[model samples]
Target: MGTLTTTGRARSVGALFAGVALLNTATVGLSTAATLIVAAGSGPGWSGLPSVANVLGTAAGALGAGLLLPVHGRRRVLSAGYAVAAAGALVAFAGALTTSLVPLLLGILLVGLGNGGAQLSRYLAADLYPEERRGRALSNVVWAGTVGALAGPALMAPAADVATGFGWPALSGPVAVAVLATAGAALAAAFLPRHVPVRQEVPVRAPARATGVARPLVAMVAAQLTMVAVMTMTPVQLENHGHGLDVVGWVLSAHLFGMFALAPLSGRIADRWGPRVTVNAGLGVLALSTATALAAPTAHTSGLPVALFLLGYGWNLVFVGGSAQLSRDLAPETRSRVQGTVDAVVWSASALAGLGSGQLFAGGGYALVAVVGGVLALLPLALLASRNGR
Candidate 1:
């Protein structure tokens, strides 16, 4: 019986890793295509709309998960989320076929909703592992996103070519890829165990205090806001400087690589030193990222890629560390609800950032967006310092 349970846990973790990878692949491809499509038809001012729709959908999805996960188990909820995202991708594909923004935005929103639910897979992974190893377990799932990071952008041009060959708009190709990828994620998630395995030992620790929850929530919001604001505008910035989709793809690949490649290292740091230390380090990196963006020339420069990579890594550190901190000492009964609620808040903040970034870029170029992101990044650090002083 013990051996059977152990095997089940392993299978579930493996499925989660695969599901995350596929979901990210779909997400990256859709994001890249959406920006280009919107910019071509609606102009630069509206390029950020796709990201706005996506994050808003994510926020709604996360909140819905908070309500549903407590009632249904992870397996059912996660599979459903991915399935819905697949349908949304198809809707976006149809929108692309017709060159209509309404269906495209609505589709991306559905995809984000699926993403919100799937993101909670990390918590399920943590639930299966012992407390001491929870960070590593969660990180492994994050690391799996490296596949999407590399593959999604790399496939963009080819996917576009395939779509163009079919006499369809190039944007439709990526959305087509999204359809396949999201469906694959749904299938992978279906393999998850209906119930998480019970931990053999429950470590004795004080219940999470308000400060414990608030601190992590602040870090997550800051990270998401800063990262989304900067990232959502980068491809548009590049295209305006005369770079093609190929260049945009490579740069985004570099950024996503930074986001996921060192996830395990961040997890180790969070586990060994502490989540607070990890978050502090992440915030410092975010500051540097903004500075790098500011220093880059107005035209295409190598500095943009470097800054984006730094931005992605910095976001990863905060996300992983904050997640660890939030999950610590959480009761099993309330774990899903708490995680879902926190993620909803984080993604909601990100939606606002995504919506505002295009306007900021339009008004003052990338500089204004970077400055706003930098300010947000530092605010959390200031709060942390004051707490320390107290």
Candidate 2:
């Protein structure tokens, strides 16, 4: 409405976008450990702490995110979430060193809290831009995280080895990674500019109307949860097929590369196709990919790579699709609260998937895990699609 060209606004908004995405490095560090730790043979009982971490972090994050609406504001909470989660990472590393499962779990739960709060980072892009430009901003934030996620595992191996050389378990990897990611928070608080002012031009919509606006947002969030739930856990599942780390890593990198590489384009797809179309199409593709991953659990042939690679590719589409939609779904009056609620729930759902995946995989093989998991995951997407982009 003012003198700012849309391009100029996006340029300014991109800084905040980078901050939010950079903070996603925490997810890379934490989730890498979250999924891999379960495969570490850290006693069956202890193997699940990472899952518990996901759940607990997300639950608290859901609540704590509400706090950002009023007191600290998004910038403060985003910055603080990174720093605080860094502490949790330290605690987790300490726990990993001592092999103290309870404390390890607690520390990760705190990471979950940090993650919960950090979920708002993507929303920041939504806050800074207008509805028309929202998709690109959201995609930019995600693409930033994609780079960090790729690096996270590479960094984890060295940190883990260092921890082992010091007569400690390798869990210190995530802790070290957490610290690295926390620096982003410091940068955010220092360099990220505030662009959105505190006033609204119209009377606020009721929760009912806001919720109506958020329907696609919620659907997209669900799509995101399903995507992360499977893609994040794929390496562990592949490892079960007796695939070596080399094989798993190759496939995972391919998967991540597929997702990360396509993020910017995915946003363009959303921008052109309409958010609803993008979300639905992406989820549909994701549903097919998830089913393929479930059906073929290994890259024994290039087929496995092709299928799982497609899974990651499809996940990129849906996740970015959903994220872009959320960024544009609501008005400023409801921005903080609605965005917080959406992210908290999305992450909480992801946590549940990670936590439950372990039990599902342990009780059953990867095939059963795939079949059951695929069915469970399909429900949300099916419901979302049933509405046909409303």
- Top candidate (TM-score): 1
Cα lDDT over the full model 1: 0.84
**Candidate 1 colliding pairs:** none
Stretches of candidate 1 above 4 Å error?
1-4, 196-211, 297-301, 388-390
CA shift at 26, candidate 1, in angstroms? 0.5
What TM-score would you give candidate 1 relative to the actual structure? 0.94
Worst 10 residues of 2 by lDDT: 192-201
Q: What C-alpha lDDT do the candidate models reach, one value each?
A: 0.84, 0.61
Candidate 2 Cα outliers beyond 4 Å, as residue runs: 1-18, 38-48, 66-71, 194-214, 241-247, 300-305, 385-390
Could you tell me how far off, in angstroms, the CA of residue 299 lies in candidate 2 after the best superposition? 1.5
- Candidate 2 lDDT (Cα, whole model)? 0.61
Q: Taking the tens digit of each residue's C-alpha lDDT, what string does model 2 give over 6-27? A: 6755554565555545555565
